[model samples]
Target: MTLTIWIDDWQIQCCGESFAPGDVVSWKLLEVDPEDYADVVGSERAREIDCREEHHGQGEGQDPTPVEVVSVTEVHCRYGVPPGAADTMNCPVPGTTVLVPVDEADGWAKARPDVRFAGYLVTARQVRGGDSDDVSAAELPRSPS
Candidate 1:
């Protein structure tokens, strides 16, 4: 059976290998908890998108799940941190971030030796502090003339 997986940006940045569409990969999958990520992904989205984390460390006895990469999308999320609160809340945005697989009648007709599935990758980008109008050139130290 085909399954939708959520691969976080940090996982790829830390120790994930480069993968593209049509590439069959073996990954350690973990069941996602919708409530845990409801802040970033709205309650509805959290349930739709499955498989949140991929464990890189060794010692797990579970075998890696091999899957074919059907697509890859860069998910852009704009969030806001409430005053006095440390956690960020999701903002109302058009379109859903969840990657739902398209059903193909003949896609899995032939069964392979191993159970292979089709999935997509979602990568998110976050921007932090930077130069702003509040900080003027005069505030910075002068360079040698």
Candidate 2:
């Protein structure tokens, strides 16, 4: 199974299937309020989950822990939203804020294996520190003073 990390409507969440006992997944949960995360319970709480082979034998003793996770985060961007968008009851427009992994422009396109371009035009720009990288001075080299 693969580790999938994405921003849902409420929080930055992650999950993995077919994970065995003692497995661990380390992740950084950003764009989520600390209060909301700490208060997670019920169907959302993943603390000490159980994962074991069913055909091993009759239930006995404590079940093995499914997985362990360690997270560190800072609350920034609007919860599961593109920065600068005003908060409202309506859902944000899809495809307008396509999240891509950090990589070169060509590399990012190659990474999107599931997306296909049928005819619609799309623009790809490098966003560095919430701003366009094209206007950054970091792109230039320094000369001896």
Question: What TM-score does structure 2 among the candidates reach?
Answer: 0.19
RMSD of each: 19.9, 22.2
TM-score of each: 0.52, 0.19
What are the per-residue Cα lDDT tens digits for candidate 1 across 22-131?
Answer: 66666665655545445445566556554543656532665565556655544334334455666677342333334333332122222223222222233212111321
Candidate 2, poorest ten consecutive residues by summed lDDT? 116-125
Question: Mind giving the per-residue lDDT tens digits that candidate 2 earns over 1-145?
Answer: 1111222222221232222223342222212222222212112321211111121222334333122322211111212344576864433233322333221111112223333211111112223344433322222222112
User: Model 1 scores what on Cα lDDT?
Assistant: 0.44
- Runs in model 2 with CA error above 4 Å? 3-23, 26-88, 102-145
Q: What is the lDDT for 53 in model 2?
A: 19
Off by over 4 Å in 1: 57-59, 84-145
Candidate 1: Cα lDDT at 56: 61
